[model samples]
Target: MHNPALDFAVNKENKTITIKREFAAERPLVWDAYTKSELLDQWWAPKPWKARTKSMDFREGGRWLYAMVGPAGEEHWAVADYQTIVKHQQFIGVDAFTDADGNINSAMPRSTWDVAFVDKGPQTLVECLISYDDLAQLETIIQMGFREGITMAMEGLDELLVSIKK
Candidate 1:
């Protein structure tokens, strides 16, 4: 239940995980959910886990804070700061865990999450790139439940993409 097989590529320096799915919908619709807070709250985390955002300023120099509720009734707080935002194209941000008050927790390793949207004919390509400094950080992430969590989270995203009720 803890470790799962994640579709990814591991280089000598870092691990790169990728998921490419065609959304029956168009690019704009898929892009909006990633940028907008209301849509993101619908299916950001994996199922069986729930989250609520405290703040979401989706712009350069902006920040978003959220709390994830675990299956065992535990809560983990995470915060992300937007560094660069290119409309309808890309979102580059630094992610970290923090307290409910949104204080930065240094214990959690910080990394940049790069999300890009590319038009695939009439469909959309939602590419998520996560980068770390070196191999050790990559291992740390894997040991910290990264593979299982990302797989579950991406599956949730895949469901949202194929759903017509969005």
Candidate 2:
């Protein structure tokens, strides 16, 4: 099992966002949570929201695309491209909002996200390091209700962790 840690913070200048979580599972299993759509579907969205993973090709040069719709039919799509993958140690990718055909929406800010799965005794430490282009871009996301959205996303991840423990 992994020992999951959970916390997220914006950089002092508000140009970056970092999320840390530990899971009481093995690195490989926890890694699958982020890389595989099957596992993601179980805990990808918080209550009142649902995730419909359009595609998840988690390999270098591959893309991960997903659509998360709220209860009221309001939907959002996101696309991430894998830049690096170091087995169970880490995964780095660029995330952005996109459309059905896997095209960058351009209307959204693009950010680099680095997720590390560190071995800690019998547990695993998962840290998500996200950096934006600038402070203004970060602010734009915040103004559009990012903090709560992110917090809720993390909570969805937590739900997944609990299910694995059972």
Best by lDDT: 2
Residue 18 error, candidate 2, Å: 1.4
RMSD of each: 4.6, 2.5
Residue 103 alpha-carbon offset, candidate 1, angstroms: 1.3
TM-score per candidate, chains pooled:
0.83, 0.87
Tens digit of per-residue lDDT, candidate 1, span 4-123: 234465454555445444454568888887777777776677778866788999989999998887779888899889999988888899888899999988767667788888886556
Worst 10 residues of 2 by lDDT: 1-10
Candidate lDDT values, in order: 0.74, 0.79
How many steric overlaps are in each model, in order? 0, 12
